[model samples]
Target: MVTDLQERSDQINSSDQNKIIIKEISIESEDQNQKKIKESKRLFNEGSALNNQNKYQEAIVCLDKAISINNQYDFAWNNKDNQLLNIIIQDMHYIIRINTKKQFYVMTKLYLLILNMIPIGLIRSNKGILQYN
Candidate 1:
């Protein structure tokens, strides 16, 4: 009967050991995820600074890394898109300035494109539906 009691004790100890292992695994996983999130935010802030300095391409690279680390990072996504838009605007302005009369058609096309991209609409429909166009 002492052997039977020993067997029961061994089983309980084994189950407790399994629980400790699972807890350790969970804690490690949480720590790794927190590290990744912190890294992602660091990269995002660096990217934003580069963007403000007009180092758009470099900023985009950093932002891409942040997004890769945290795909659901909305701030990174929006910042990247904004940087791309700024680059496009700068390029369009340069082209218009450099090719004024010689490429009036191209300049006009670019202007139209920019105009169409206006983000806000103030139109009010007859039914007061707040039309965006």
Candidate 2:
């Protein structure tokens, strides 16, 4: 009977030790998560500073790093998207400036093509009647 009681006590002690180990592991996991969050935030701040300085590409890189560390980082994603949009808008403006005449010519050709697709009967209808099908 004494041996049985001792065995039960040993089992309870081991179970308690297992619970302590699990708690320690849980604490370590939380610490690691907190560290990642801190690092991601730092990267985001750096990216924001770069963006404010008009260094869009560098800012995007920093934001990407932040997102890689924490995919759920909404601010980094938004800032990266904004940087890409700014680059696209800048490129569009440059293209427009360089190809103004070419764009106008293309638009005119498109308009003429559309006009030619209309039926002559409708275009020259009597009483100014016009219909499209």
Candidate 3:
């Protein structure tokens, strides 16, 4: 696992190097700043170790950090996962049903809420649009 992390880290370094080259050639947007993948890899390796020792909560924290860095990481879900992510689906259902507005309203609000709470981007207002908040 550590070896894997190191290999991944090397890949990230290459990616970052590429980014640096891009920035040198063209103007980069704020959103274009690649995450500091170094720290994320360290966290991933630590979490993997914790998971092997059956420290689930600790592992989850580390995995969550890694996910925050790179949401596409399936490795974060690998420690002790069930095929069913029922809890997440249940939460989504409850969020929609609780505010039983129109279907579109419910779905929009559900996504907005998750975006607001999670590090995901918000879908709603800056100057109080009152559209979905």
Best candidate (score: lDDT): 1
Instruction: Report the C-alpha displacement of residue 63, candidate 2, in angstroms.
Output: 1.1
Candidate 3 structure quality by residue, lDDT tens digits, 1-133: 9999999999999999999999876654434434446666778889878766756567778878876776555555443131122334455677667765665765676677556644653222323222332
- Provide C-alpha RMSD values for all models, in order: 7.5, 15.6, 18.8
Model 1 local distance difference test score: 0.82
Candidate 2 lDDT over residue span 33-65, tens digit each = 999999999999999999899888999999899
How many backbone collisions does model 2 have?
0
Relative to the true structure, candidate 1 reaches a TM of 0.76
Question: Candidate 3 regions off by >4 Å?
Answer: 1-22, 25-35, 80-133
What C-alpha lDDT do the candidate models reach, one value each?
0.82, 0.77, 0.61
Rank by lDDT, highest first.
Answer: 1, 2, 3
Which whole-number lDDT from 0 to 100 does residue 99 have in model 2? 90
* Model 3 residue pairs with clashes: none
Candidate 1 off by > 4 Å: 102-133
